[model samples]
Target: MFCNQCEQTAKGIGCEKVGVCGKNEGVASLQDLLTHALQGLAIVAVAARKVGIVDPAVDHFTAEATFACLTNVDFDPARFETWIRKTVELRDSLRARAEGAGATISNDTPALSYRPAADLAGLEAQGVALNFIPSLDENEDLRSLKQITLYGLRGLAAYTDHAAILGQESDEVYAFLQQALADLTRNDLGLDELVALVLKCGEVNLKAMELLDAGNTGTYGHPVPTPVPLGHKAGKAILVSGHDLRDLQLLLEQTKDKGIFVYTHGEMLPCHAYPELKKHPHFYGHYGTAWQNQQKEFAEFPGAILFTTNCIQKPRESYQDNVFTTGLVGWPGLTHIGEDKDFTPVIERALALPGFPNDEDKGEVLTGFARNTVLGVADKVIEGVKSGAIKHFFLVGGCDGAKPGRNYYTEFVEQVPQDCIVLTLACGKFRFFDKKLGDIGGIPRLLDVGQCNDAYSAIQIAVALAGAFDCGVNDLPLSLILSWYEQKAVIILLTLLHLGIKDIRLGPTLPAFITPNVLNVLVDNFAIKPISATPQEDLQAILA
Candidate 1:
């Protein structure tokens, strides 16, 4: 297995045996095979589109299958086998229709005619033999760019799936996904073409995120400023983690009067600010920090846990029985809730367990400063900036990881000037999320802008602020200090680049997949920089 698509790739190169995320060689190879199959499906799907044969099911499956390959989303090799078979099934179906319509299908690559092995063991062997990552391109530089596009699409697929779940769908987004996947299977594309496709991945991801923002806010209502308890309520409880709101809502409804108090965990923390969700009296406060800390945190929680999306750790035996997974998230033995959205198993498990024995007030933290809430107070923010009370804005947020350098975000947020406003999103905010940064002219100095899934909210906030100041987003006295762990962050960075945003500082370590030549292109065109030796050093340069 050769996997290097994440921030913490083993030894900062590639995970050649077991993945640092606990993905075994079998699962890693299966994921690669699934991705390879998707490329074949994409090639056929793109041809089908030429013949006006677009199937929504094919489009949705393409997104879900690609998303399933994302880091930490699914660890069960069985699930990968299922996805691989389904991808081939869809590809064959599309190929038949397209050929019937006189559209020629490409069989130039083995993926075009590939078939999965009859069993999991055989399939794993097939995947290892056909592994495409190392052999993608003879040119290391072009291979690096392909890696970027591939991972960016993984992130894009995730967002697209999230939006589709909430009844937001776009053909354009689906079309781009197919075309990009097909383009990836080509060998003639040069560096510039690949770079443009990478940027386009970012641009389409913005649309996906916007659709998700609409689905979330339209369904749950715009998040309002709400203070959520870090404390636990004494009773039966179910902790929901990951980034799916619909899963949380379904669980909340099923456990409504059943004495199970639902608590948000990880990225689900922002769900508490949504009006429809917050109205549940049994819905309790947040528990734990980011996804990286789940092993320690989930072990201590007394009740059942439901993981709605990604950010899953290999479950330790102690609490493995207490955990359940739903949607596209999968673990080998965890009870998976199906499309029916039923929470009976989770509810029964919560009932069987002893929840928090006593109430503990760990104080509270404020959230719900998404675009709507922030823009609602646009006048106040504008006035504060004009009066120099809010001298600058620092957007210091992205995916957080367990690496040593992550302390940079916490320390960086600490060093942010008192007069400046700090807007953060995703799990990275956990570093200084609970810090009391006070307020400037009635505006909270530290604003929690929802989850990484709510990145559209953050982008909208920046755009609105830019409009208010009559400047481009890059000119709005804002410095983006972002830390990425997985594919979602990759696509979000691409979106920022797509907008021609410049001078951004990214770190904890740049992606292992980014070749120096490609990094130079980013640096020359966008002035992108690695995080400084110290947050203080970066701060001095930015404030200069």
Candidate 2:
């Protein structure tokens, strides 16, 4: 039951006895088995492709299965057991179809199938099956390289699953995951092949990101600059967390006019900027800072907290009864909202609670109005630049984690030059939310672009700025100093690479899965570097 695929792995290493995320040994082992089975499915899909029989269902199942194994995604061993059985059934069905059609499949890999060992004595009996273990390459470097690619795909699958729930599907991304997963299972492949697949994972993940961006913006309208309230109003309220905008939208709709105020939590904080979502008068401001503060933040709150996706920690008994989970996020004893997307139970609980004595509105928290909204004020922004008011643009954003080294983001934002504008997104901005970074001319110094998915907005703004200056994106005065905590970051990094953007700095710690060979490829190709020294020094290097 050793798992360390996330930032909050127990004790900064693998979670051995029990997952800090509340996943038990059985659930962890099942997730491992599920991952192994998905890889097996990928093997079959890839082989079938060689024979010109590419089943889209096989590709999608692989994506969903891989996504389910992501950190904090599936904690219910019972649910995953069903998924495993279903996957095996799918694999067998696919094989039967191919054989019935008389298609000559060259690769004869066994279908996705596994049985628990006969002896269920202790921890070792429940440990992940050997087949599920990532192949241990003869070369230590290659093993690391395979891990990086595999983990990166796991992250990509998570994002893709979110998009799928919103009715956004990309065949190309699914196909790429199948191809990449199959490639990881191949120990015969050399460093060059694995490296190419690593970069390709990045490329396809970029497309996946674009699809999600479109899904969000197209459905909700472009996010505009809007200030969210920080104070919780009296009465019943619901705190919606995680990164799924669609879930947030549904909750907002169901709770509207019901006297239950909806507030954005964690990554959902950015949803307030969307015109369609913001129009809801009852949509309150953000609740707390980041995911890590949830245990304290959720304590004794007057309402239920609904988790739409990842980054949920095991709840304390005090608030455990009030927490509701929807979509793929699951945990024992938590109320789960099913596929219907109905959130009535959460709304009901919020109403049942004795809310604040009055409508206690928190003060204004600035957000919304990202690139498109900002671009709407493009004339003003361009004028400010021409007037020498807005000097430099600092893109400071990425995931937030429990690691102490994450304090770098706080220090980095605090140290930004007064005249420079700080653009942020995702949970990483929580580090400096209290800072009075001050605005350049009229704009605020800390401008939140949106969620991590809104990295697209950051990219759009950079490209537009490059176009305005008649230069390449890399030549613009903007600098990307990012903090990554998960796979979504991996996809965003790939997008940056796909655009040929260089000199990007990442931190707080480098992924343990990346082998030296793979790291060398990224260094040589993109000049990506780890965050070191003080932010001042890093800023100097980027400016230089």
lDDT of 1 by residue, 339-455 (tens): 998889999999999999999999999999999899999999899889889889899899999878899899999998898999999999999999999998889999999999777
lDDT of each: 0.92, 0.77
Query: How much is 467 displaced in model 1, in angstroms?
Result: 1.7
RMSD of each: 0.8, 2.6
- Which residue runs does candidate 2 get wrong by more than 4 Å? 8-13, 20-22, 49-57, 106-127, 131-136, 379-387
User: What is the clash count for each candidate, in the order shown?
Assistant: 0, 8
lDDT of 2 by residue, 1-544 (tens): 7776665666665678887767887878777766666666776676566666778777777877887777767687667766776776776677667666665544444334444333333222434544344444767678766766777898788778777766788878887898787676667888787767777787777777777888888898987777787787766788889888888888888887788888888888878888888888888777888988888988957788899888888889988988999878888788899989888888888888776577656566678847777787777777777788877788888988877788888898888878788899888989886577777667788888888888877888888877887889988778888988776777678768868889888888776566567788889989999998688788777656
Best-fitting candidate, scored by lDDT = 1
Q: What stretches of model 1 exceed 4 Å from their correct place?
A: none
Model 2: lowest-lDDT 10 consecutive positions: 115-124
- Residue pairs with clashing backbones, model 1: none
Global fold similarity of model 2 (TM-score): 0.92
How far off is residue 57 in model 2, in Å? Answer: 4.2
